[model samples]
Target: MTEHPHVNIKRYRLIRTIVIVWMSVIVFAAFLLNIPRINILEHTARNLYFHVPMWFTMMGAVGVSAWHSVQVLRGGSIISDIRAAQAARVGAWFGVLGLATGIVWARFTWYVGSDIWWNFDPRQTMAALQLLIYGAYFVLRSALDDPEKRARLSAAYNLLAFSTVPFLLYVLPRQMASLHPGADGNPAFSEMTDPVMKLVFYPAVIGFIGLFWLLYTQRVRMSWLAYRIQGESKY
Candidate 1:
């Protein structure tokens, strides 16, 4: 196997350090920063820094996966295949975190007095369905034995799954009556957001996306190393 030219170890380490510090500051400010609080979204409003960014990071990861999947389909390179799979895996975890955070956030804010942890809110439901689609991509990979064939087939399935992300997370949810912000003609978080919150929100999004890239790159490196150690050059 050829040395990976694209991954710069020194640069990656530097950026990883930066991301660690950046996210630490973002988290500290998210909880400690004073901002105007709305009626229902009092203290829980701090979740905006964490929850919303998780989805943004997930979407960014999915985009990276789709891009590498295209590379796999175009050139059938094993390295690209490895990247696509790792990107999707990391991205899917972010999606799961986003859903979990949303659930906890809603439990306190929306369904505070009720025993409902989940009420099938349209946005939440669609997000869950979207994750299941990605889940199938992994299962499909496991079912196939040939590396090249698995890469090809799973890349195709991954593209199909990526196609539904926008609709499931954005379009369809906005069309339905939902408790989530930016649904059913409701104002988006951006529209009515305080400028103070945006200070932390934007950086949080960038930090989480950087985190996804870090994790995805690490997995790809490990996978490539494993293949090399096993005497499999074609991967």
Candidate 2:
């Protein structure tokens, strides 16, 4: 029963406080900001604040998961294994949130004409497929009987499947026709845009990122503590 070094109770409290303040700011900004009337149709670009941040935060979580998976494979430490598994779980949760938010945004922005609930947009399809792949990663981890074998196989699969995330999130979306705009080429903030939108958008991104980190770190700490307790009980 080895003690995990990274689990700190005080750090968790600090993260919780930061996330609460960040989320409060995002909510306040969303409510107070004046959404501009872009065309004859009023465009509530405010939704971008929430919608875009979800995807970014999800990607960040998944990236952390992938890194931890690699660490488990290479380091072969139980703490690393626990952290990786917890990271994957958290990342999967955020992935679901991102997909739901993206769908809602799409419905509001582009579902004006067609009765089809989901158009075969490359970005949307790829994002959905990515989520499914990670979901399977969790199921695979659960189905295995041997602990060491489970850790090895799950870590391998996690690293392999992680390659798809960047491709789906960045590459394919840029190459093909996507209803969602490409993030890489264009400036997120432009001088031409309304000052109020910029004010809200930047803070929303920060807030959501803070929220994601807070959750991920908390999950990691809790998982580490559980592993330590289980080991102690076995002795």
Candidate 3:
């Protein structure tokens, strides 16, 4: 079956506008809602709405890359390769945002009076290492001259590297003695019963996820367009 050409600019614009408005409203609500105090737990909780979304989005990007990797390995499709590369680019952006937001949260909640920048915390170290691994994937892609080889090798690397994300985001943090609270430990809100906080927090997550999808679609479309342009020049 032939694919339908259904690139509706109006629909894309409407969806984009809705996502932007939703994000703006969520941010405004987050700022206006008055919490009792700026204690360590409370301050850290604020970062949940921002930092956690970054990490989640990053994972989503990596997942896309992995799916494309599988497609390329199985079918040798250039579209899959293009998608994998685009996803890595987006994932890198989200990873950087996650790290920056984490740093800010760490400064306010963990390093209350200190100026030390690099702590040996497992969460910090593992997250940084994850970023470095993904960065290397880009470097490897640029270093290769053959498109087929680059695609295959990068796909392999993506699969291998993505395996670390779950460990870094979940396992490592839970295993080590860190300033950040573990999933099952104290300060963990596994059983949050507050209706007001839930109302705000759940929407914030959904809004941020929608924003991530909007950006990902735009980036992938641009990448596909660039690929088509390049291909046409040689035809």
Tens digits of lDDT, candidate 1, 1-235: 3457658788788989999999899989998889997998998888999999999989999999999999999976778988998999999999999999999999988898897999999999999999999999999988888887888899999999999998999899999999888999788888878999999999999999888888888998888887778744343
Winner on TM-score between 1 and 2 is 1
Note the Cα lDDT for every prediction shown.
0.89, 0.75, 0.76
- Winner of 2 and 3 under TM-score: 3
lDDT of 2 by residue, 43-70 (tens): 5566777777787777877788788788
Task: Summarize candidate 3's per-residue lDDT along 1-235 as a digit string, tens digits.
Answer: 3331333566667888988998898888777776555455574566667777787788888998899998898976777887788887887788899888888778867886797666867788888999999999999888887778888998999999888889987787877777766633535445542455665677777777677667766776776677667762210
Model 3, backbone clash pairs (residues 3+ apart or across chains), number: 0
Worst-scoring 10-residue span by lDDT in model 3: 1-10
TM-score of each: 0.95, 0.85, 0.86
**Candidate 3 clashes between residue pairs 3 or more apart in a chain or in different chains:** none
- Regions of model 3 farther than 4 Å from truth: 1-11, 36-38, 41-44, 183-186, 191-195, 232-235
TM-score of structure candidate 1? 0.95
Shift in Å, residue 136, candidate 2? 1.4
Q: How many backbone clashes does candidate 1 have?
A: 0
Give the winner by TM-score. 1
